[model samples]
Every structure is written in structure tokens, then in C-alpha cells.
Target: MSDLLIGGAETSTLAALASPVTVIDSTTSCQDVDELFRADEHLGCLAVHGDGPGRSLGLVSRVPFQHLMSGRLGYGKLLNTRRPVSALTDWSPLVVHAATGVAEVARQVLDRGSSQRFSEVLVADPGAPLRQVSVTDVFRALSGELATKALTDALTGLANRDHFLQRLQQCCTAPDVRRRLALVYVDLDGFKAFNDGHGHGVGDLVLQVVADRLRGCFHPGDLVARLGGDEFAAVVQLPAGVPVGPAARQLGERVRACLSGTISLSSIVLPGRASVGVAVASSVLADGETLLREADLAMYRAKAAGGGRVELVTDVGSTAPREQFAPDRRELQRAVDEGEFLVHYQPIVEVGTGRLASVEALVRWQHPRRGLLAPGAFLGAVADAGFAANLDLHVLEVALAQFSRWQRNLGRAAPRAVNVNVSVQGLLHPRLAPAVLDALSRAGLDPAVLRVELPEAATTTQLDVVRGALGTLRAAGVRLTLDDLGAGASSLHHLTRLTLDGVKIDRRFIAGLLDDERDAAVVVMLLELAHSTGIAVTAEGVETRPQLEALQEMARGRPTFVQGHLISRPVAAEEIALPWSGGLHHLHAHVPGPRSAVPTAPGPVASS
Candidate 1:
């Protein structure tokens, strides 16, 4: 017996058997079909038979001709309107031989139903020509199969992080030579605070808000994924030498602006900010680990630069002698783990006035064997240190604690803000906002008084993750500065992108700007840039009269601030006490006394 046709059985056979049998050449158009339908009402379709499916060999139905005659249709669409019958007919159509079991036929149809074509399985005789031998009809068999297969992400509707990662890994390894990879690690700034401040419902909204923003950043081929809580990642192929730096900066700024100010979620205005960290991988990443590490490092840099900023991690080749330097890495990581990271404060003073303006908190590692080490000594060694986050938290806590101590001991609050250096790791750490708020709460200090300094290199467009993180911090009334200005693209790049309160001129230019014309030009440009943007410029590392005088002169024209050794050196937080009485005059009058030890002005001021 021939294969049994199931459900539409008799109807399908009658439709196929009763169909008009007339040969029509491939040249026949829908207009030609209209004539046939006009001539004979019984004609429904004229089967084209030749070398391909388009070859009109016979007529099958009159309905298709009617469609042509009524002007409800044009010529055959499959060919031109015209979807190739071959295109509709899946070439790699699932098939089973005539002897195949019914269960096997069902399985093949089920599997193929999930594919792109979603083609139906057909049973055919192999010994003879490829004549149809249907065990079960197409629609009835495949519909149930389609229901069994699932969409990728079961929960969020969006692809899960794992799926996104696998996709990105494949993209990284794709043969496309121009394929550029950028992973933006976005940590919703103050999301925890939002969650804690409001209920989880509000928190979910915040996450959704971030999800929407990430979605907006997507291009045609870009993929954005939420890496579980608070953190999200994006992979994109960007144009080469396209200055992803600026784009990252713009992304950071946009994310900040989007989340900042009053976020009115049904009158519950969520005032928040975000810090973003971004890593760009052009061509293929060296490997998965390197890709992740670079992205992570970039995020850390963003966090370091006071969040709400962008940081890019350039692939510095594996030039470091890791084998020889392996011991240093272990030891440094150990030191960080053991809480051996030390933070020392350096004072920033008004250049000509010689009054303290701020204290810059610097980090030190008391390596037992190395004696003392600045960041330069072991930055690479501790680049991937596990305790980096801990160290930043400790420093922030200590800085705040020390600031509080200074406030209490002195008769008056220190005449300046305490400038603290924050690392990106600390900024994007899950605990960042909470830790900062906790420290402030414990110290009974106002967040406004502290100035967090971020390095120039870290404040780029590519650090949106850091930006979102910083956005959270900024919402809490924390003051931020883009430190080490004039060092990189950040000087010009950040002024427009970040919502910074001030710019700290890096020491390199400020230390010599007064004497070197070239340095002076750079300083002048910075001063102008800051003033134009309404951001106060603070000149750091001024040690001589001429440098101080130049800075003072520059400030005279443009509203600029100055800090350096010219005013005072780093002192114990206790030493720079202000008088309870009148402000600077009282402190100045008692300056030479035991209460105040103002370093004597050395000789006549030397001109640069």
C-alpha cells in the first residue's frame, strides 16, 4: 500500500487529483494564467516543469489564475514577486526512505522544525525515482514539534549571559579580519542604594532602565548582556582607528545624563548616577582570558577615575619578564591581601598665598623586602591582584576616617577639602556606594567635603561601566576631579564628557610651566579649557616662586586654583589645624609659634 496520508487525507488527495492537468511553459506569467483562468474556470494552478521548479509543465489549480485575473495579484512573486520555488523548497529538506519507521519520520520532522527553514520532512522511495511517500502530512506533524523547542532566554526574553558570551567568543574567532570587539562592563551605579533605599520593585526598574540604555547602544550586530547583577557587558564591531576613545567617552556621558538628575518613575524620582568601564578589542582577542582581563582592567580604570568616566586598556604586549618577575607579583598580591597597602596624604596649597587647599591621598606598599614601593614599582605585579578592591575600600575608609579626625582635632575644620585617590576597582566594586556611604555615616562627615581625584588616562569614552558606577557616587553629593590633566587625551577629551567639579593639572606641566614656555603653553591651554567649561583648574606640583607666580597670574585672568610644595609639603592630618577664632589671619599670626610651623620663605623669591 502507498504511504497513508493522515489528517487532511481525502481532502488533500481530492485537491491534488481533481486539480487541472495542463502543461504551461516557464515563459507564462500571471497574465498568461489569467487568460487560462478566463478561458477555463476549472484551472487553479499551472505547474511549471522543465529543468527547474519554474518550468511550467502542467496546470494544478484554477484559484491561482483567478488571483491573477482579479488584479489582486501580479506575475508570479516567487520568481520575481517571485520567491524562487527552489528557495521555498528546502534543498536540504529532511527526508526518510520509504521503509523508515513512523517514529523515525516524526523525529526528523521535529528536529528540522526548529531550524531556520523550519522545513517539513518528506518520505520518498530511494530505489525508484524520488516520488513522494508521505507517512504523515507536513503541517500536522511539524506544528507539535515546533511547540516543544524553546526560545533562547527562558527568563528575561533577552539572551542569557552565557549565550551572549558564547556568541561573542564565536564572533572573536570569526574570519572577518576587520571584526572589532568592544566589551562594555556596566555596573549600575548606586543600584544597591536604590534597591535598599526603595524596594526591590524600584531596583528592578533601575535595572530595566539600564537594560534599556544598553539596548539603545546596540548597533546592527552588537550584543548586550546582563552579566547577572548590577554588571552588564556589550560586544560590538567598531570601525578601526575610529577613536573608540571618543565614542567610549560619549557613551559614558550619555549613560550619566540618562541616569542623572530626577529619574521620575511614577513620581518616585530616582536621582542616581552611573559609572562605566569599557575595553575595546580590535581584530580577534588574543584569547578569552585576555579579552576578559582587558575589559576588566578598563572597568577598573574607569572606577578609579571617580566612576562616571571611561577607561581603555591598551593591549600592552607581554613584554614584562613575568618569569623573573613572578616572585614580585606573588609578594605584592600577598601584601595587598594582608592589608599592607598604605595611604599617605600630600597637601595641596594655594601657590602664592601659601595656604593649604587640599590633601592628595597617595598609596604606598610597605613591601618588607623592597622597603617602600610606590604604585610605579609594582603596579604591574599587582595589576591583577585580588585585594585591589579591598585596598581601595580601605583607603577610602581611612581617608574619610582621617578627614573626620582632622575635623575634630582642629579648632576649625581644615581650611581645605581632603582629596582622595580612588581606584576603578573600588568604584565598580559591588560594595562601592555602600562602602562610601558607610564610611561617611560612621565618620559623621558630609560627602561634599571630600574631593575624589581620578587619573586622566581613565576618563575616556570607552569606560561607560565606570561612568555608571561614578554616576551613583555623584548622586550622593560626592565631589569629583579629573586629576593628572594634560597627560593624555583626557585633558581635552573629558572636560566635555564628565560632570566634573574641577581639573587637577598633572605635575609634569605644573612643576615646570612657570619656567618652560612649552609647559606654560600647555598649562595655559588647560587653564583656558577648565575656565571655559566652568570647571575650576587646580595646578599641582608647584614648588618654586616662579611656578607659583605663573599659576597665580594665570588664575588672575581665569579663575584657577593652585596646589604644590610652594605652599606646603605633605603633613600629618593633625598638623594642618585651623584656628577656632578668625580664619586665616589668626592662623597666620600664630604660624611661627609652636601651634603653627609654617616653613620659612627661603631667601628672596627667584624668578623663572
Candidate 2:
């Protein structure tokens, strides 16, 4: 909050005051001067000069510069940390002409320092063009009142969101800020659960505990801030000699153990834990935002990997990256434009009969560079960035068209049934049934021949939407299958309310069905429930001989179905083949028009 000063008559204040400066166009190398600053034992300061002859642009301090050089800034440690001294000098030593009042100079100082990485202000006289007028050092000139008002978080007495953002931006924009940085985004696990179980009083206590734990984790030079609610962020400049990764790992582990460990209050133990997403940017990250994103993503990964554990933020270039959700949205549009996405089909065969009852339509990405990637590689990206609905619609259209062709070839008696897995959006969308019915009618395909599958875990809070959609689908003769049922709680309510055509037991529950007693018992119970409801059961992920045998035993004297790698893996659309002969098991001919899209390599179905 110090008055941003410039030598000019008047200037508007910048968003942030303390930021690093990089000379995008400088004649002198700051490297030699930077080394000098690092080696200095007292009054550590860096004087930056602009590109023009005999011109000083701005100055930087030793502490912030040290933070940048040591990799303690934003994602500074992950990617390239150093920039040409010329770049630093080009923007540094900001010049403001004299005749500028203290208020005007303050505003200019604020505006310039808001983005650049400099803690001090340089005033120049207008009459002398770049001559010095006065110096307003950051810590020395800024009053305590202004500092308190600008930096402190009103709720937690830590750094506020704006201050954190500005500081992080500087670390990201600063030259060599990426040399080393350990950025962490922390969220208290089950904090909401506390509110649900013990009311707001307990929730507030939980927040306080989290705040205290975070405060205890840093040094005097480190920054700890409450971004809001139960979320907090931290930026620590690690010691030059210390390795960034190990130190960060230690801190993350401590955070996990300390937060999750039981806390006793008035003899009532609160089972509190936290999920921390950590990203080391010193060597891999490019900016503060990227660093924060990586940490947030890693934290989510940690939570997904089962909370109370730490995960390193790797897979920078893979689908796991945050940008995975927002890749050139243009690229997605381009993919659709170029028809780079292709439909593949996997047969959903009956277990004992080994006969194909239907095929599951799956999407494959024909990425120009990545070769062929599965939906897992890019579907989440599309879905998360608000494109799933369109993509799902496209898949449905393609699937219906393919089924129409397949049914025509199979003659009048052939089953037109095609199973297409819909995303959560499609399942929950109010227009889903109408959309599917319209596709079926347009294709002249039987609605009964189309089975729609939805992932159980993806269901949203609007259970009624799914119920209504599924009800409409059922009434229209389009079969509905609750996919990945055992992977999550699909709730018997959905099953009973919607009158589903069937349930596809998740691969996880059916995996190794012959051995796991618990999985086997669940499968049996599911089979009984399906039978009582007059619904068919399809066992998914059945791979081994024992698994098939177990399924057969369960289906003995009963009508049940199975789908997995043991029968066939998903394959390209054109590769899908049906037997010419009436007998189910004979594949005696070799026609090259198209191979079955099923996976040729013999691997067990994915562990559910």
C-alpha cells in the first residue's frame, strides 16, 4: 500500500507493488550483478538499467531476488529458471521524470511494480530526462499501516488472495523465478463432513486447526495465505544448498500426517485430515498460475489415489495435466472438424453361449502426433472443459448410424441392439431420450436395439433428471443399463425408480470373481436383485477361465450375460464382424475388407 511513486507529474497505481522485473530489452547482463548481489553480506540490492545509453530503469532487493534465484518462488523450480540478464536490465531501474509529485510518483511506482519484480522505486527528474530525483525503498519507505492493509488476509490474518496472486505472478514473471519453487494448494479433507456431522462450530474448529498447521509449516521468510474457506496456499524460498524436491516432499508428508491425525477436543476426537496437491516448479513449471494448477491437480490426484497420501505432480505433457482439460479448445474443434475422432466397437458377448448379443461403441482419438489414444486420454479433457455434451451427441449419432448399417446387413431378423456408453452429461441431460429417439427414428433403426449405458460414479445431484431420462428411454423401448454399478453407489432407488433394463456389474466387482469371496457375494446378491426385478445382469470385465466359469455357475439355469476381454476387446468400427454361419463359434474365413475391431492381443479385462 506504499504510495507508488514515479518522477512523472502523475500516474495510476499498479495492482501490486512488490513484483520482480525482467528487462526484455537490456544492453548489460544482470548475471554478473546478480552474482554480486548473492555474494553481498550487507545492503544487498540490485540496480537495473534500461537499454538506452546511460539510463537506470529500476532496482531490486536481495531477499526477493534470492527467493527467485534459490527456486523458492512460484513454479520457478520446475521449468527454465534463468532469463538473460539483458531481459532483466531492459525493464529494470524504472525511470520517471522529475516534477512528479509524491502521490503521482507513488501511483506510477505501484503501476510499474505491480507486474515487474522490484521492491524499490527509482525517481528521475524530467528536466534532466533520466537523472535521479529520489528513492522510495519498499520496506524502508512503506508505512506499517499501508503494509497491514494491503497484505494481510482479513479472515485468517495471513496473506489475502490478491496479495498471494500478485506475489505468485511476480515469481512466475520474474527472471530465473522458476529455478526453484515449491507451490502447494491445500484443502481440508471432509471439512464439509464436519459441518454435516457436528455443525458449523466443528467446521470452524477444523478450519482453525488447518490454519495453525499451515502456519507452523513455514519459516519467517516463507508466505502462508488463506485463499478462502478451507483452502490455503504457501510459497517458501528454500535454502540455496537444500534440494527442493526432498524438502517439499517432507513438508507434504508432514502436512498429511499432522492434519489427518486425530485431534481431541473436550474428549471428542475429530478424525481430521487434509489433501495436499504439490507441484515443484523449479525445474518444470513456467509460471505461478501453472505451478498453482499443477499443485491443485496433484492434490486431486492424491485425493483420487485415496486421500491422506501425497502425489508428486508429474505427467506434465500428458492428459493428467490441467491443460488436459483445456487443450487448444481449438484443437478439439479441429479434431471434430477433421473427423480425427473415430468410433470403435467391442462386442458384449453372452458368457456361456459366447455369442455376441451387442457391441459397445467406444471413441478413439486419432491424434496426429499421439497416434491412436483411448477415450481415457482425452475424453475427460473434453468433458471437463464443457464439451462433453456435444461430443456425446456426436458419438450417439455415429453409433446409431453404424447400427443401422449393421442391422441392414444382418437381414430382417438381425438384432439392431448397440450399446453406447453416454457421459454423465448425456445421462443427466433432459434432452437425452428425445435425442436418442430422434436418432433411432432417423436411422430407421429399432429403439429396442439400442442400449444406453451410464457410469454410476458420474451421476450428479439431480437424480431425478437421470430417473426421468431413463424412464423416457425405457418407455420408448430403448434399453438402459446402469454401468459400473458396483464401482459406486448407484442406489437401489435409481434401479427401482427407473425400471432399468439391466445392470452391468462394474469390472471391479466382477474382477477375479472366482477368487474374491466378497466380490463373488456381491455379484450373487446383484444377480438375485436383478432377477427379482425381472432385469437381466451383464457381468463385465470377466477375463480368466475361472471368472467365466464362475459366471457360468451363477448363470446356471438362468439368463445372464458377460462382456470382457476374454470374449473380445474393443476394436475399430469397420473391424466389427458377425458370423456368416448360424453356429456361434466358427470364425473360419479371412476377408480383408475389415478386421474385427476387438482387441487382438490377449490381455485380461481391466481391473474394475
Candidate 3:
């Protein structure tokens, strides 16, 4: 085989292709070379040189030398068997420099086609002995690596979507008429909420837990795969005596039970549940795509029926229309146009000095009948309607405009930065950078004053696009932060991959800090990680004085920021008071109407 090709063109160099070689001196005899080959049967070729390693005289391959010596008119009869190997060496063998790329070397070798019996290339470096690289080695490595990656999901180490589909197809077309195959589609309940509220890190932990549970619930022969973000599918082969419908239902129930429990992470215990849909192949000629669609529809039905339940494709009662599971797109579009959305600012303060550092921009819906509604009430609806990006942009524009007003009113007393959440859709948008920059330009605010916070889950789903947008933002002098750091499935790996300015410790961990020693330790470790990486740390949900005191103690003189009702409830743009009086004095005078005073003990706080 020839060197690896990219787009039908060879581009690898001999340096990348080279492997350690067995070297022989110029005076080494044929018998000695034969003995060396005998000791290591895998050794295909040998390098012979004079004086030192840099002086390569020629090359000799095992096959050609053996063939020449074994011929009827062989060198054995004309010369001594112990003669120096130089007598049998090819003085003008193909040789390449160590710096030569694979592409050029492949072109030169492959151009000879099958007529040439070359199996390896000799790579030479200045002042060093030649190294041998077998074409077979490169081909095997590349093929094996590509095949493994193509079949596996990098995050969870499970079979990926493509592999799942292929296996499903095989099951549908298998030649056993009496055998049955079942496809179970599992969608996690409240996963988006968990991801959105917490962070992708915690969300990822949930996914990994769900994957492990799903794998444990199935038979060894079954195939399980993560079909992307909180959704999983499995192919189960029914036993000979088992009925397909009953088997599938049993599988689904077992899966739901296994996954519907609490996932313990560090100091937090997150609830987990899944809605499952099952579809069985009816015939050998069953269509894979149709079966998958049926299973998906059944899953949606299970979700619509309040989730945490199993629904089968053959059950007539499970045939709910898809529309019932999704929010109306037109309604969302109308809301965007009718200006039903509002922006709220929640304060983030320095834990030591209690100075106002920044405020995060949160979106709310001023519903005509529902009064003021938080994002949890309608963000999902907007996302389901494929209007999340628009809503995010709208929120950004409103927040930026309001921030400009605040800047004008308070002058130098304005908060250092105004953070706006960027949804996955918004982050992946081609116009995200331009739209953000445009909003800042229109508001006449410097880019440094507008920080973009992304959920951790978004980082894993569309990594390249998110990284690109973040790069553009960082280049523009805008700050970037990872929100809900311990809320969802987050990894320390993200801190290295992403260009982040800071991390917001999830409120749950902060809420647990007073009572949970583990939580306090986790927070301290997170702070250490962030500060060591040159990233700032903000502890969210500091409602109680105990929590604040705990965080302050943990800070150990480091600058830690805290955000929660203990400081101030999220208020309208006009109500934001800046250059905080270095304490909670402002909270005493400007408490929002009809709301309970901030809780003092370790408990839930008003949502930020």
C-alpha cells in the first residue's frame, strides 16, 4: 500500500512515516544479516553504512537478497557465504530525506505502481542513521483509527448515531423470519432545563449517568447509542420464546426505572427521568427509517403524556399529533414582533468589598394575562419554535440599549459589565459576532462592558462554531464566561478548550455550601482552578449570610463575586443602582414590592 491520501492527493512526509530501523555495519556479512532476520522475522530491511551512522552506503531488503541468494546460479556458489554484506547491497536504492513529506514520497513510490516491489521507505536525517517505514504500518494505523472514531461518540464512548442507524438497518433486514427486533427511543425529561439552569458540565454528568444506566438495563446483545443531547436509542433482540411487544415494553419499563433516579455529583444530587418509545420490526423487509420515525413519534407521545412513561408505536392511544408536543412558531414570532419580552438585571457583587461588579441580563415575558413571566416560562417554547436565536438577539439588543441608558445616568458608577446569555442557537449563528458588535455600536458602549455568557452544554454540541464565535468576541475585547459551571455536565476539559474570562459557580452548589462540606470543598477547588487559569470566579445564589460568609472564607483573600437575592432581586434597567456602597445597604432600602425578605438560613433563594 502507498502513503495516506487526502482528497486523492498524498500530503504526508517521510518524517511522519518513519519507524525505528535495524542498522548493520559495512563489514557485516551475509550470514550475519541472515541471522539478524532470523532473530526478528518482522525485520523487512536493513541499512548498511561505512565509518559512522551518517555514512549510509546502501540498502538491502530481505525478500530481494533472499531471492538473489536462492537462485539456481546463486552467489553462494560464486562467493563465500560469509562475505561482507556490501557485495549483496543495492548501491542505488530509493532514499528520501527525513524532512520530505509523505505526499511527495507516496507520489514517487506509487508512480512506479505494481512493477516495483517496494514495501518500505528509508528516511535519512543529517548526522543520523536511516530509519525504515513500512507502507503496511501506516495503512493499518490510519484505517483502524478512522474506523474506531467513525463508530464511537467521543464524549460518552458509546456507539454513535450513524453506527446505531446501520445496526438498526441490519436488524430490520436480517434473514430470520421468526426473530424479532425492538427499537427503543429514550428522551430525558427536563434535560434542557437542567442544562440551561445548571451548566453543560453537570448536564454532561447526567448524560453519562443516563448512558451507563441504559447500558446496564439491556442484554449483552443489545445496541445502545446516544443520539445527541439527552436522547438515546437502543436495539434489542427478543428471545426465541418472547413476544416482541411484551419484550419491548419490558425493556422500556426497565430503562425508565433504571434512569429515573437521582444522579449524585460531588455535593449535588440531580433528579433524572426519561420518556421512552418502543417500536418492533414486524417483518424482514421492514423499513429502518420508518421504524425509527415511529419510535421517535412514540417518544414524543410519552413526553406529551407528562413524561417518565413508556409508549409503544402500536398503541392507538399514543398517536398524539406532533404539534401537541411543540410550541406554536407563529405565536413566538408574534411575541417577538409585539414586544412582549422584557430584560431584568441581577446584581453580582464582590464578596470582600461588597462593591457592585456587574449584572447579568435575564429575559422575562410581560404576558398580557400571565403578568410578568420569567424566561423558564417561555424560553423553551421559543426554542421549540426554532425562535431561540431571535429571542436571544432581542434580549441582547434590549439589554445593550438599557445598559447604555444606565451608563448615561450613572456615568462612572455604572456596573463594570452587563452579561447577556447566548443560547446554543445564537452562538452557532453565522451573524452572531456581527449582531453583538452591532448592538454594542448602536448602544455606543465599549465591547468590554458587554460580556457574553454561554451554557456549558452549548460548548459540547457545536464546539467549533461556539469556539469561533468566542474567538471573535474575545478578539473584539468582549468578555466571555461559562455560566452555571457546576449545574450540568461540565468538565474541567472545557476550561482548557474554551477561551473564557470567568466562570459562574452554579447556584445549587452555593446553596449547599453552608450545610454540605463537600459543596464547600468543590467550590474552593473550582475557585482555585479558575484563578490558576487566570479566570475570575463568581458564586451564584448567595441568599443567606452563612453562604456569603462560607464563600468569603473559602476565597482566602481571592476576589470572589456573589450573585443572588441576598444582594438584590433582578430589577428593571431603571432600578439598577451602581457603585454599590460596599455592603448590602442598598438592599435594605430598595427591596422589590410584595417579595419576601432574603432568606438568612441555608435555603432556596429567589431566582436570579
**Local distance difference test values of all predictions, in order:** 0.54, 0.61, 0.70
Model 2: per-residue Cα lDDT over 21-131, one tens digit each: 333234334455456665656544545555565543555555655555556455532332345444433244555544343334433444443344335454443343233
**lDDT tens per residue, model 3, 1-608:** 11111111122346766877877887997888877877888888987776645445677788877775565776562464678888777655557898764434543554344524375677889997679887555433333333443455545667777678867766665657214667789999888987898898888878877777776777666777888888899876666787657777887898889988888888877777889998776643344676788889999999999999999964221233222224477877777689877777888888887777888888777777667666655665677677888888888988888878778888888778888998877878889889899989999989999889877656465866567767888999999988777544334446657888989887656765775443554566567667655788998877777777778887887878988877776766655545445464334533342132432222233221
TM-scores for the candidates: 0.42, 0.48, 0.48
What is the model-wide C-alpha lDDT for candidate 2? 0.61
For candidate 1, report its TM-score. 0.42
* lDDT tens digits by residue: candidate 1, 1-608: 11111111011121121212354454555545555667865443344444555332222234423433344354343333332222222234444565543324443444343331232233345364332322224333322222111112222334445456656656655657224555666665667777898897777676766666556655545666666767777665555576766765665565556555555698787655656665655543443445666676777777677776666654322333122233444665576578676665655555345456667766666667666556555443444555556666667777787777777776364645777766655555676667777888888988887787765646465445577766767898888888777555335456556789888877666654654444564566556656655787788766665666667677665556665554444434445444312222223223221222443222211100
Clashes of each: 55, 58, 20
List the candidate 2 regions with Cα displacement exceeding 4 Å.
Answer: 1-325, 328-330, 412-416, 458-460, 580-608
Model 3, global lDDT: 0.70
